[model samples]
Target: MDNNMLILSEGMHTSIQDLGRKGYRAFGVPISGAMDKYSAILANKLLNNDEKLPVMEMTLIGPKILFEDNSLIVLTGADMAPHINGEAIQMNFVYKVTTSDVLSFGNLKTGARTYLGVKGGFLTEEKLNSFSYYEGVTSKEKVQKGDRLKIASIEAGLNPSSSKIKVKSAHFKEKKLEVTKGPEFNRLTKKHRELLFSKEFKIDAHNNRMGYQLKNKFPPIKNGEIITSTTIPGTIQLTPSGKLIIMMRDCPTTGGYPRILQLTDIAINQLAQKKENDSFKFDLESSFDFLGRLVNRFKD
Candidate 1:
């Protein structure tokens, strides 16, 4: 019931993303949502908002905005060098913007995606129990220009906190992502698996809402008759030509051609932040073994 923010100039590809549309993949709807969840969760949690509330998920950079009323918001993930009314804003913290104040985000830094959580959830019409998924949607579209965002809270006289208390931060600290070996991971030649971790792979610029293409030595497989099977986000599928594609939040519900491996939850979040030329190592593990490690990770 709050009119806090309004989309003035929609950026290249900004979407109202939460987690994803669960339980509807069987109907051929891709799991559509934000690519990097770590930042998204962190940004929203700072404001004590629910995980299901839709937020502005941006790739590379964010769009310009003009507030309909005074609001406080927080930003997380890669720094995109934002500015408010020609005054630069800080990263990884919460700040305030007033009505008619213009805000712009520059190019992305180290990572690919960033999350911005306003005082409350971004209020968009819920279509099919979600504002996240945006395929075959007749009611709510992804997001368009001149759209008025319905927020949850209002400010009688609330404005940017003048005290200027800096926001503290948390360490993502995730590196050397673990993976569950694929159905065709063993099918590749012994040298292929060796080369996978042996050399570093660079993320390609051909990335978008769908997936990221990783470039490396390009492995080979002898027998490639794997049936068309179910695929999910974080699935690392390899083409016959040996190119690796890490399915993102908007990834297809299913695929074929045999995936090489599956990135764990922690790893996929970090992978979503990677832009072109970012290099990282991949570690292979058994499904049960990796799951146990993840369970332990959450415990700690």
Candidate 2:
């Protein structure tokens, strides 16, 4: 079927997200979606969907999906042990979801979120011109178990069988995020500036789509400025305890804190998928380099 959709089992942490709805930010709206957009868009494309098709953005655990009708679907981003009717299914590959069949996501295998997208995509209520879900800004809310999804109508109806799946590329090889010092980057001494990237911080459990709080073994802020003003998604805010926070997709539009460094957009998406204490090195790649690398990462 084209868009006839049914949620057989909504995973514990699932949200409807696309590229994101813009123009709501002035009212404190956030552009929320899969942290790993590279993979997110890849899934949509596999379904022959537009780059902005609404996809199921699942966390470390994926939800079970029951199809009301037959459809071609794809899963991308982090590895959430996926299985269909108890049989293991692969990630980053397109598959067919049949009516009366069950699609279940078990646990987080690698990254934090897994994205599920169907051919064309399921149509949900829109807010500010986007089907991407936010804090219930529209009638639709974050995806939950047993939710019924209405397709765009045209995207549904077509029947499909098996999938000609493609391979996925390495994450680290392509993307680079351009980081600029935060608003309060000046607050930290020169030494702090140097150590911001030089120092290694461990991601803590107290992290969410809002931001990632990193454990600082060596806090560099001494005569740090007073904390005030909002922070961006990639902002690395330093707390009084010297902990550093890297904001993410659902991060508040504003915050009053001493943000010393900002992870570039590309890295924000990449690192967002990282598990707790998953160590990675940072290279101060420029915005130009980031885009160039990402484009080259994929084989044409």
Stretches of model 1 off by over 4 angstroms after superposition: 1-4, 138-142, 155-175, 285-291, 294-300
How far is each candidate from the true structure, as Cα RMSD in Å?
A: 3.3, 4.0
What would you estimate as the lDDT of candidate 2? Answer: 0.71
For residues 92-172, write the lDDT of model 1, one tens digit per residue: 666776667777888765566667788777777676666784757535554567877776665576554433233323223
Number of the top-ranking candidate, with TM-score as the measure: 1
What TM value does model 2 have?
0.83
Model 2 stretches astray by more than 4 angstroms: 1-4, 139-141, 153-178, 217-227, 286-300
Q: Model 1's lDDT to the true fold?
A: 0.73
lDDT, residue 61, model 2 = 67
lDDT, candidate 2, 150-200, per-residue tens? 765433456554554553444533333347656776777767667766765
lDDT of each: 0.73, 0.71
Report how far residue 169 has shifted in candidate 2, in Å.
6.3
